[model samples]
Every structure is written in C-alpha cells, then in structure tokens.
Target chain A: MSVTSLASQLQGLAPADGSYADLFSSVLPAVIDAIGEIASSLSTAHRVALAGTANTFGDDQLNVDVAAELVLRNTLAAKCPSVVTASSEEDPVEKPVHSEAAAVATRPEHCYTVAFDPLDGSSIIAPNWTVGTILGIWEGPTAVGQPAEKQIAAVLGVYGPRTTAVVAIRLPGSSKADAASSICLEIGLGQGQQASQNSEVLRSSVRLAAPPFKTRYFAPANLRAAAQDGRYMALVSNYIQQGYTLRYSGGLVPDVVHALVKGHGVYVSPVTAQSKAKLRQLFELFPIALIVECAGGLAIDPADGSRILDRVLQGTDERAGLVCGTAEDVEAVKKALLA
Target chain B: MSVTSLASQLQGLAPADGSYADLFSSVLPAVIDAIGEIASSLSTAHRVALAGTANTFGDDQLNVDVAAELVLRNTLAAKCPSVVTASSEEDPVEKPVHSEAAAVATRPEHCYTVAFDPLDGSSIIAPNWTVGTILGIWEGPTAVGQPAEKQIAAVLGVYGPRTTAVVAIRLPGSSKADAASSICLEIGLGQGQQASQNSEVLRSSVRLAAPPFKTRYFAPANLRAAAQDGRYMALVSNYIQQGYTLRYSGGLVPDVVHALVKGHGVYVSPVTAQSKAKLRQLFELFPIALIVECAGGLAIDPADGSRILDRVLQGTDERAGLVCGTAEDVEAVKKALLA
Candidate 1:
C-alpha cells in the first residue's frame, strides 16, 4: 500500500492566505530532520552519558540533550529564514536567529517565533525509553505574552524504537466553519533519509474517539503530588476503582501522545505545596495543549480548570499543571481536582 | 564509534562445551528475524485491525498477533532444525516440528523445545505502543513438566519505535563459579536488514543495580486488585509515600523491560479474588523470569514469594502473578504483600 509523506500532508494543511506557509514548508521539516539526526546519534554510547551540565531548570543534561539543542538551533537558523527567534528548554531565553540569511526587509508578519524542548524526557533517555522534541511556532517575533491559540502550528518528534513525529497545524482566527482546516498528522521519519523524502504519514487528521470511550486509561504525572493533596489522591483512587488502565511512562511527550494515539486516555499533572509542577508553558504545555485541542481533546489548567490555550503565555519558563486528553476524562479530572 | 553487533556478542557467550550452541547460533537468530519481519509488517494499517478471533485464553487477537505467530512459526520451521517442538500463546499446545528435517536419530540432548508468546501485549498494539515477543528454550523436546531453571535460554523481542531483543543464555546446571556464563544482551534490530547483519549490541551485559538504589521506581500491574486486597492497596500507598516513581506502560514486555533497563524498578502483578492473574507461566512468566534472573535481578511468585524459576511447568496454560526486578524492590513487595 502507498503512504503519504509528512511534507505532502503539511502541504495540504497550508492555508490559502499563506499565514504559516514558511513554517509548514521550511521550519517544521528542518526540525524533523534535526530530530532524525539526534535519533541516529543516540545509538552511540558517549551521547547517552551525562554532559556534566544542567539546563536552565537545573535538570542534569545528557550529551544527547546538548547535541540535540545545538542540532535543532543550527538547523533552524541555517534552513528556516522565517524563524526570527527561537528558545529551547536548555536555554530558556529567546535568541535571535537567521540574522545573516534574512534581510532587513523580511516581513515580520511572515516570520515565526519557535519555542521547543530540544530533547524532552532526558532523564529517561539513558534507559532508551521513548522521548521527544516539542515545538510551537508562533506568528510573530516572540511567543511571550501571546495566547496559545495565536500559535500557528506545533510538532512533536517522538524518539523511540522508531523516529516518528506528530505535526498539528491550526491557522490563527479560523472560524468554526473552517474546523476541518485544523489537522493533526502522525508521521514516521526514515532513519537515515531526509525528513521530506522517506517520511510516511502514519495518521492524518487524527481525532479522539467520541466519549463514553469503550476503555478508559489514565496517566498520572507527578504522582508525588497525590501525597500532599488529598483531592489528587482521591482522583487517582477513583481512576483505580473505575478500572481505568494506568499508562504513565514517566515522560511527558510519550504519555500525552499515547492518549492521542489510543483515542481514549486522560493525563493529569497536578501542582501541590510539596510537589511543584515543572512543565514549562512555551516549551511543553502550550505545544501539547494545541495538539490535543486540534485533535478533538481538551487541555486544561489543573488549578483553575480553564482551557490551557486560553491562558496567555507570560514567559518562556512559566510552569503549570495540565489535565489533557479525551474530553470526558479531562472533565472528570477537573471535577475531581477542583472538588 | 565502533559498535558490536548482536551476532558477535552471542558468539562470545557460546560455550566451548556446545550445550546450547545450536540455540545461540540458529534458533535464537531465527526468532529475532521473525520479530524483525513482524516489526516491519506492523507499520501497515491492516495489520493493526482486530482479527475477530480469540486466543486460547479468550483475549481478542489482533491481526498482528495472528500474522506474527505465523511469521515466527514459519521462520523457526524453515531455519532452525534443532527446534524439536514449539508452542505459542495463540495455540498453547506444544506441536512437533521438523519431522522431515530432523531424523529419528537426532540427539534429544541437542534438540530444544521452544515456548513462546508470539505477540505479548497484543491488546495494547493498536495504539502503536511497544509490544514484545517472549520465548523460553528448553534443553529437551518438551518444556512441559520441566522446571523453569531447566530452560537454557530466553529471548524477548521488543517492537516499539525501534525493534530490539533481549537475549539471555543460562546453560542448565551452570555453577555459581560460572555465573558469567549466564549473560543477558540487549540488541537492536536494523529496521530493513537481516537480524545478524545490522543488529547492534545496545547493552553487552545487562544487570540491575545494587540495593539501596538512590532512585526507586514501581510498575503496578493489576491495579484493580487493590480494591479486593487491602495489602495490595497498602503496597501501592507505600510506594507513593516513599516517592517511588511509577513507570508502567500497560504492556507487560515494556513494563518489565523498563525495570531491566532502568536498573531499579519493581513490577508487581497480584492475584485477588476479583482479578485473577492472567500471565501464563510458560509463555510469559518463564521467559521473563529467566531474563530477570540472568540480569542479576529477581523474579518471584507474588503469592508465596518463591523464586519463579523454581516453579515447574505443569501445562502451557498455567497462569500466575509475578513480582520481579531489583532484588531490594522485590523484597519490599514480598514484605508488603505477605504481611
């Protein structure tokens, strides 16, 4: 059977107004290519070793993480002139990009700001568990202070036994009539080939199954929070009593993406006085929330039970708890956590 | 950096006495190839669909399971003459193999019996999560009525974003002075290449960390059992209270392998009145127990806390609960459950 590639699928999602045409055509594919390179390099023993440095968040960095950040940054700067600024989990502040490639007359409206976690789940990488790279492309020079809905597209590069990516695109200000325009695509990257060539679109226009799902699953991130908060503990207990299958892999990208692929799972990360939530807004939460929402799921702030997309991004390093997945499961999380 | 392939590692582990030379050289490589073929076939959409047939255990079999069993059965039949009998999870009864290829004079000592779960965790395959193949190689024509320790070798093929296999070899009657003879190797299969050619030895000799692990992790299978057994609930509660990380991925192969790769995790599958444990003793438990034991870890019967390897295989369909991983964590599970 024939399969469509990621580039072709992205081409189909590109808007008539050309709002994110450059991102769809250039920036995202480069990011995917960079991820493929990282996947190949990960098999080397030295790359998986500790880099002896910490990220901005004080998490110990692996050699793969440092190499991944560099590869992504360099790929974006060299290939995507439309990417005016970029920030990574390793270096949280926004940095200028493509200074030599983009002319002074380059249109700010056409340019995009990229925020990414170059190598997420680094702690679990040594074990060779599935980890990922998360990216959100915003329509302007920076993602700071912008509502998550203002983002044009998001891509999650999953590095597991295979290198695959989840690419979701939603044009800003699209109406309900244009709902079909929002798309989520799961694509497989060929091991040693360019992202545009051998990449296969595994799933197109991905959406969760309508709820009252036949089987329910729960991924409780930061389970430590349950110790300090009785409500969180109660929520987990309820999941167990209801026979919800536990699918947490202790990695944000895999856990969230698993829910999407299964078409029925709830992933809850709650904040508590003793255990603070550590998911960064720009690098992780916003991108993941967009992909979930575009795929007919819900992503919400666990504390206030508001749509995560509606919360404006205050800074690059802003952290928050998220309740995301099948709409019904997310709603259940809100009710249980807020009670 | 130069990397050692799985073939070379197996060659190194092959004993000069030639007890399991055929298994290490022929049968095991054939099994890995079958897994590689299954991995390649899994990407097709049709293979992931339901097969409308149930295994002997009454679980719904996916098309992949049916196809995987055929692929493995055929590969073994065609390539490995040393395999005298084989049985699979789908068809639990042991069946004779290679009647034409193997003469009546074929030595029983050299001939091996194989019991396998062609596709363990088939229930979770639809979501494109990692699943695996489990196999135990007995020294004689039949694994039935033989103790698990009598098995000379075990292989686990993991199909995830990448295809990999954990092959463990422990010659029957090996002494403690020859402990190094029992080796567990984690190998990566090349996506589109032969098992022996492109496969890399990801980890040469796999082992668990010593007790008092700085970071602890737990994978609690059959969480629903907590409702019927207060001790199970208390065990889970203690894990949370001790701040042990949860790393369950809902697939038996991935959960157990995660503990092996992490070097510190306890996987508990408990039996209660309401939730009868479903892991088959021969196909799933014996193979996994061998690998864990070979890797310097412990695999025990959750009910009585005896070494799982000491159990005799009465039938292919016998099922039991298991608590396996780092010795310390397994000790903790026995203490909490047996209290």
Candidate 2:
C-alpha cells in the first residue's frame, strides 16, 4: 500500500510563509534516521551493560543510552545545519553546534535549538520494553528563557515492535483559530524495510480518539510519592476504585505516548516534598506537552492547573510535575489532586 | 552478523529419542510465522476497529483479534499435522483439527493438544502497546485432568516494538536431575528481515537474573482487587513504601515477559470475592507458569502458594490468579498476602 512520506506531511503542514519548514524537513527525518540506527543496533547488540558513568541528572548510563546519545547528537550536528544549539538529557547542557562564523552568517530566525532526551527509558530498555527519544525544537539560538509556545515543532520517536514517531508541528505565534490546523501525526519509520535502506514513513496522520472517551486508562508515575502524600494516595485509590486500567511502564515517553495512541489516558507524575519532579522542562516535558495539546488533549502543571506551555523555561534542567492526556481525564486529575 | 535460527536452537535441545522435538520444531516456527504476519499487518492496517462480536469469554473482539486467531489456527492446522486438538481463548473450546481417520492412524502418544490465547492483549492493542500470544502444548488429546508438568512445551509470542517469542521445553516425566536441562529461550522473529523471509533467532537462552535481585519491580495485575481485599491493598502498599518500580502494562503476557526480560519482577494477579480470577489456566496461566519456571523463576497459585505446575487442570475454562517471578519477590508477596 502507498504511504505518505514524513517529508511530504511536513511540507503539507508548512505555513504560507514556510517559516521553519526547511529546518523541520531536514531535522525531523534525521532524528528518525538516528533512531532507526539505534533500533537496529539494539536488535543486534548487548543493550543492558553499564557504561560505568552517570548522566548529568546522575542516572546511571546504560551502554545503549550512551550510544544512542552520541548517535543522535552526531546525526543532528552533521545533517541539520540550522540547529545552532543542541541540548541533550545525557549531557544536560546546551552546546553550541554552529561555528562562530556560521552563527553570524545565518539569521537568528533561521536557526533552531533542539533539546532532546535520547533514549528516555534506559532503565526499562533491558527488558526489551518500548522506549523512545524526544525532541523539542525552538525558534532561535536557544530554548532557554522562551515560553514553550515559542517551540515550532516536536518529535517523539518510539522504539517498540516498530520504530514510529509522533511529530507535532505548530507554527510559531499561531493564533487560537490556527490551533485547529496544528498537526500532530504518528508515522511509522522503516517498517518492513531493510536497516540499510533510507527510513520510510509507513503510516501517517495518527491522532487520538475524539474526547468523552468510554474506557479510562492511567499511567501513574512517581507512585512512590503516594507513600508520603495523602492527596496523591487518595488520587491513586480513586483511580483504582473507579477501575482505571493501569499502563505504567516506568518510562516517561511510552507512558505519555500510550495516551496519545490509545485516545484516552491520564499520565500523572506528581511531586511531593520527598518525590521531587524529575522530568526536565526543555528536554522532556515541553515536547510531550506540545504533542499532547496538538493532539486535542491537555498538558498542565499538577501544582496549580496551569497549561504547561504557558510556563517560561528557566533552564535546560528545570523539572516539574505533569498531568496530561484526554481533556476530561486531565480535569479529573486536577479535581482529585487539587480540589 | 549471522544469526541462529530458532529451529536450530530447538533441535539442539532435542533429547536423544527426539521426544516432542519434532512437534515443537513444527509448531513454534509456525506460531512465530503467524505472529510475523500479524505484526506486519498491524503496521499498515486500521487496528482499532471492532469486529462487532464478543468472544466466548464475553470480551469484545477486535478485528485484529479475529484475524490473529484465524492466522494462528490455520497455521497450526496446516503446518503441524501432529496437533490433533486446538483450543483458542476466543473460541474457548477444544476442536479436533486432524481428520478422524488421520487421528486414528497416528499413535495417541504422537498426537498433541494446543490451547492458546491468540492476541492476548486486545484491550491494550489500540494504543500500539505490546500485546502477545500464549500457547501450551499437552501430550495427549486434552490438557484437562493433567498437571501443568505434563505439558511438554510452551511458547509466548510478543508483538511489541518487535516480534519475538519465548519458547520453553520440559520433557514429560523427566527426572529431577534433568530439571536443570529444561529450556526457556527468547528468540527474535523476522527482525530486520523481510516479511516473507523465515523467522530468525536474534538471541538465545534468555533467563531471569540469578535470584536475590538487588532492584525490585512489580506488575500488579487485577489492581482493582486491592479495593476489595485489605490484604491485597496492604501488599500493594508495602511494595510502594519499599519503592518497588512499577511496570504493569495491563497485559498479562507483556507484564510477565517483562519480568523474564528484566531478570527480576513479581507479577501479581490475585482473586478476591468481588474481583474473581479472570486468567484462564489452560490458555494463559499454565503456559506462562511453565515459561517462568523454565526461566529459573517460580510460578505459584496466589491463593495457597502451591507451585502452579503441581495443580491438575480440570477443564479448558478454569481460572486462577498468579504470583510469579524472582523467588524473593514471590515470597514477599505470599508473606504479605498470606502470612
């Protein structure tokens, strides 16, 4: 069966001005290519061995994690010249990718900053469960200090039985009316194709089911926080009593992406005094928030019910709790945890 | 880059008399091939649509489930003439596959009964999460009235980011010394290969981590049972307080397979008066129990802590709860719930 290429899908979503179109066209496919390479290696290599070092977040690095970070970083630097700054969860600091002469030669509007969590579920990878890569692209030289709304596009690469991506494109400064045109698509990559062959988009235009969902699902991250926070415990108990099907895989990307794929789910990563929020804003939560919102869902800070996109980024490593997914379910989470 | 074929791996483990080896050689690859067909179709097909029919178990049947059942049943019947009886979770009844004359011509000792849950996680499939197939092969006309130990072989097909299978073989009536020779191997099927190509074994001899696991993980199936039983709730509470990582995926095969793949996990599906046991023994629990036990972990009836392998099956539709994984975690569960 004929399938739409991701490049064409991005082209179709390009604005009249075609702003950031060329950058996304070049960067998103390269990111998928990097993921395809990692997926191939994972199928053939020793994945669970320790790399004997920790990321900047102090999480011990797996060999696959370290290798994936390098593959993605190198792929972007070599293939996407428009990326001026690259921030990775493994390194946790924004590194200037473009030379000084190139930076001055290109206008700031033409440059983009890409913050990514390469291999987000390293802890769960050994079990051969699904893990993923997350990329958030911001217009300009850096993602820091800008509100998430400034992000032009985001890509979530899922490494499961198939290598697929959820790509969300929102033109910078799009009006509320244009929100309807903002596209969040799930595309398959290199499915039924050889590893050496160029990545192919096998499926396109994947979206969540329309709201007022019939079946309820929940992925409660940071369940350990329930031990300390009575409110959190009550919320979990309420979900259990209400018979919400549990789908947590101890991975941020798979848990959140499950909500998008299944059409209805609430993924709660709440923070208490003891269980501090661990998801980074620029590297993890922001990209996921944009994808969720573009898919006609909601992503908000659990602390105060504010839209996550409305928050200004403070640093690359800034962390916060998130309650995101189907609109009604997100509201239910807010009512249970806050009200 | 050369990988071993699953056929060869099974052949290598064949006893001197080749008892049940030929049957396994025929049935396992056919199952994996059927899974490959399902996996490839899932990449391109409209998967979330319903067939508008309910299985004998009263669960709504997805189109994929119906297709998968046909594919697996047909593959087994066409490829393995030794399989005299086939039972499916969707149909939930034993049906003769071979002609009466063919069955009468063949020795009863050579014939087998296969009970399987084709497409085990239909509820979780819409989200593109991992689902699987579970198969148990008994040595006679039926699996009923036989202890799980009478089962000569079992196979689990995981349809996740990849299509893979865990094949376990234990010779019927083997001595205690031969118990050490029982095999549970995880083999990748058609990975990085064409759909028409034969299944390949990317890895072999997958085993659980040696016990006394340092890190604890739990997949609490039937979490709603916690609401009805205080003991179940307390057991869950203890796991939370002790900071066991959560990895439940609301799918039996993926949850149990996660334990084997990760080397340490306890999967609990407990029955209460309100939340009665739902897992079918002949199709779901027995095959998984055999695989877990073959992998050096333990599978037990959550009610009485008896070895699941010791229980004699009374019928095809028998239901029970399971607590299987690393020995220490299983003990912890039995203690918290039964002590």
TM-score of chain B of each: 0.92, 0.90
Question: In every candidate, what fraction of the native interface contacts is reproduced?
Answer: 0.34, 0.42
On residues B244-295, what C-alpha lDDT tens digit does candidate 2 reach at each position? 8888977788888887776778999988888788889999988988888888
Model 1 misplaced regions, further than 4 Å: A1-6, A28-58, A101-109, A175-181, A188-192, A200-202, B1-5, B33-37, B40-59, B102-109, B175-181, B188-192, B198-204
> lDDT by residue for model 1 over A17-62, one digit each (tens)?
7667787788877878887887766644322432221112226766
Clashing residue pairs in candidate 1 are A161-B161, A161-B162, A162-B161, A162-B162
In Å, residue A31's CA in model 2 sits off its true spot by 4.0
- Give TM per candidate: 0.89, 0.85
For residue B114, model 2's alpha carbon misses the true position, in angstroms, by 1.8
**Which lDDT tens digits does candidate 1 get at residues B94-169?**
9987675364656445788888898887555544456788988888889888867678888888776456788888
Instruction: Give me candidate 2's TM-score against the actual structure.
Output: 0.85
Task: Count clashing pairs, candidate 2.
Answer: 5
